[model samples]
Target: MDKDKSIDHQLRATWQAVAKMYNEQAANYGSTMAMAFVLLTIDKENGTPSTALGPLMGMEPTSLSRILKSMEDKGAISREKNPEDGRSVIIKLTAYGLEMRKFSKSHVYQFNNVVREYVTEKELDSFFKVTSTINKLIADKEIYNAISQDK
Candidate 1:
């Protein structure tokens, strides 16, 4: 394989390993990595609508709404109808959600440390830039599809 292809394969393998690690610990964390990030995003934004979280998590709106309902029922979050837009409901973390955030932070820090041990800072920076570019490209494709579908 070409050098670039080899590196790409390695990067994917590394991501898979990281995902497996998260899955193994998800029960202890009370959420998957994706769910944890959704909570963190809501925390950062103070609140986020269920609609927005779905797109951010790359999940269908109905599926995300179901998950959010479960979280609310579990006392991890609260959802309120957005006064300005009744069609969208905003989510806020409860005390339990805040505690989960603290736990996730430590785990994330440890994960970063492990990655740092394997890849130099400069290499990681470059890798992130490339990954971001790829994300942007994919996002644009999604946007285009949405726009086309509205016709």
Candidate 2:
């Protein structure tokens, strides 16, 4: 099949481009896109549980651990024992982290604003609906399961 005609190819290519753009922007702040994502995922007022962060970001534990360590080294985040769950730790953003979060948020907003300028609201709504349906199909295992069951 031609890559240009493949749905997955389009999705992957667009995401790669978006990631590259974000990474370039993050480099200006001496950070990576992953770190910026974590900064955004974390709650500002109440720290998020370390365990929850992985699932929230759809990231693997090992990768998240490395990112967390780097953020800690940079004083962007601090870990504290979760009061509600003594077994788990909570990840809280320090003052510097909060500032970084703001910067991350602004970049995100700018990206969306630029996209909105080019795309109509109706087009964006359709794009979101299509993506949501794609996610649901994958999450429900309806794609491969159907093929395997037919065999």
Span of 10 residues, lowest total lDDT, candidate 1: 37-46
Q: Residue 30 CA error for candidate 1 (Å)? A: 3.1
- Minimal lDDT window, size 10, model 2: 79-88
Compared with the true structure, the alpha-carbon lDDT of candidate 2 equals 0.98
Best by TM-score: 2
lDDT of 2 by residue, 1-151 (tens): 9999999999999999999999999999989999999999999989899999999999999999999999999999999999988999999999999999999999999999999999999999999999999999999999999999999
Candidate 1 yields a Cα-based lDDT of 0.77
lDDT per residue (tens digit) for residues 76-101 in model 1: 88888998899888898888888877
- Candidate 1 pairs with clashing backbones: none
Measured by TM-score, how close is model 2 to the native structure?
A: 0.97
Backbone N/Cα/C clashes per model: 0, 0
Candidate 2 off by > 4 Å: none
For model 1 the TM-score comes to: 0.75
